[model samples]
Target: MAGISGLKVIVKKNKMKIVVLISILVLSVSCRNKEIKSVEKIDTSKETEEIISENKSKPDTSYTTDIPHIEDFQNEVMKEEDILFNGRLKKYFTLSEFETVFGQNDSIKLLLEEEPCYTIFENKDGSVDPEDKYLYKEGSRFENSKDKVAVDEFKFTKSNFVLFKGIRLDSSTSISDLQKIFPNATKNIGSMDVYKEGKVQVIQLREDENNVSDGHINIFIKNGKLYSMHWWYPC
Candidate 1:
């Protein structure tokens, strides 16, 4: 009877050992699965960071908010009809041509001593006087070089001289009127002393981003009325 009890005890011990071994195997598998999950999580985070870095390295190509180029502004806002002066825009004219437009050569005053030498075609009419309304060939010694030149600029102090599409220096013209006429025109606010009050606006065309050329117009409005205008173009 005692021998049979010992055999039963040994069998019970063996069964407990088998259960412990199986538990250990299951725990090992669970730990390995947890390690693999941790590695996968790290890889996913790394991939996400890489994607974000790549996106940051790429250049932004959106120009929707950028100011339009000068040429584009002219084409879109101030069309050819709006800028025609005496049926022509900023064209170089020979002395004969200028004479034909203004009158005989003797009537036109050629200012040789002035810097950036220009010519004057004073209106005998009292409305727009004194300020000879045209720039001679810019950067040329007018006394020496008889080269062909044109009216590179026009200074308008009176309301009678129409600048663009019947727009002139008059009480009827206002900042709002200019804004309507040139929707894309840029303001020279807080830059030049003349524009400190945010009243002067600059209209430029044919000037590139690098400022390779000089072609622009300045309109000054005071007390909500168009005060004066200056139109300029490269020779």
Candidate 2:
């Protein structure tokens, strides 16, 4: 009976050892699987980072061809007859010539001041005179209110004028389009860039240069659209 009891104890010990061995084997396989999954996750994360880096390094080629080189505008001469003021292709006009085309019967108001040197012609209602709303320097002469008075500067608060190249100086003009039109324009003065062609100057404003006023051309722009244009003659 004693020998039989001893044999049973030995069998129990062997069964316990087998159970521990099986548990160890299962634990080893679990650890290996976890390690492989961790490696795969790290590789995936690295690949994702690499893709993002490559995308960020890529150059933006969308607007490259749209904006022409500044050199393209160098030595470019626009015809004087192409500059339009109220459909009149004349950079500067005499008061007589203006009345001749619009007829002498038109009602226009002329405000002549000598202190600051300005001669303004507006509508009878004190609004923008599309036919003739110009500001000139002092000493500008007009014989009988119908004589020639070289326009020093003009304003287009209500008139629609286009450049020789069909570039409209209205509220619909864009800064980019303006840059393309006058590639030689200066960087920016306040909210607008000034382009000069002899006695004429074209001023364009960005969204930022609209608030400050200095009596120059007040170009109004909203949401990248030119809404209004003011032309101040270059002194």
Candidate 3:
């Protein structure tokens, strides 16, 4: 062995080596912890994105899905509505009763029995025609296309209507307007049969067998509102 001073120097060198090893170990542990944190953040971000995507893909839960198809759902709704809304006890009537429901004289003009009847539909913007606006085309029979009747009336021989409007609710309308038109009609029976004119309201009668119904009326609905009414006329 060497002198005591030599021994002290060797001890000092051994301690320095141990300190370096400890520092290297601490740095490795810190790097491992940082990598773990990065992985956790990535997983959380991916999970959040998946949740958002799932929410967007889901459809409405409130609508009925028990039916096999969309049409089945509609049929079920109509059947349910008929049961709930129909309250008429008068099933069938004689020709006199038919005349009683419909007026004795001509009230509604049957202008377009061959083609579609014309009626002016209020524009959707709910804007009434401007007072100064005149619908016309230069040297044309129709002043303007917009000036023409906006509504078309059709006579239905069947109980069901499958008509649809792409950009508009063609069958949708307010019941208030019908009420105002037909003050005599206090309630709806089997079909949509309400009409309004000054003080006299005409009833539109619809029948499954063409103007002969003692029970059931069919109402037309569109755009979440009542469009038209019809019940059978006893013939």
Best by TM-score: 1
Question: If scored against the real structure, what TM-score would every candidate get?
Answer: 0.37, 0.34, 0.30
Q: Per-residue lDDT for 11-88 in model 1, tens only?
A: 999999999999999999999999999999999999999999999999877746777565654422333345544344
- Comparing candidate 1 with candidate 3, which one achieves the higher TM-score? 1
As a whole number from 0 to 100, the lDDT of residue 101 in candidate 1 is 51
lDDT of 3 at 207: 31
Candidate 1: segments with Cα more than 4 A from true spot = 1-82, 86-173, 180-186, 189-217, 220-228, 231-235
| Candidate 3 positional error at 22, Å | 0.4
What is the clash count of model 2?
A: 4
lDDT of 3 at 49: 100
Q: What is the RMSD of candidate 3?
A: 18.7
lDDT, candidate 2, 10-104, per-residue tens: 99999999999999999999999999999999999999999999988998777666666765434233344555654664645565565654334
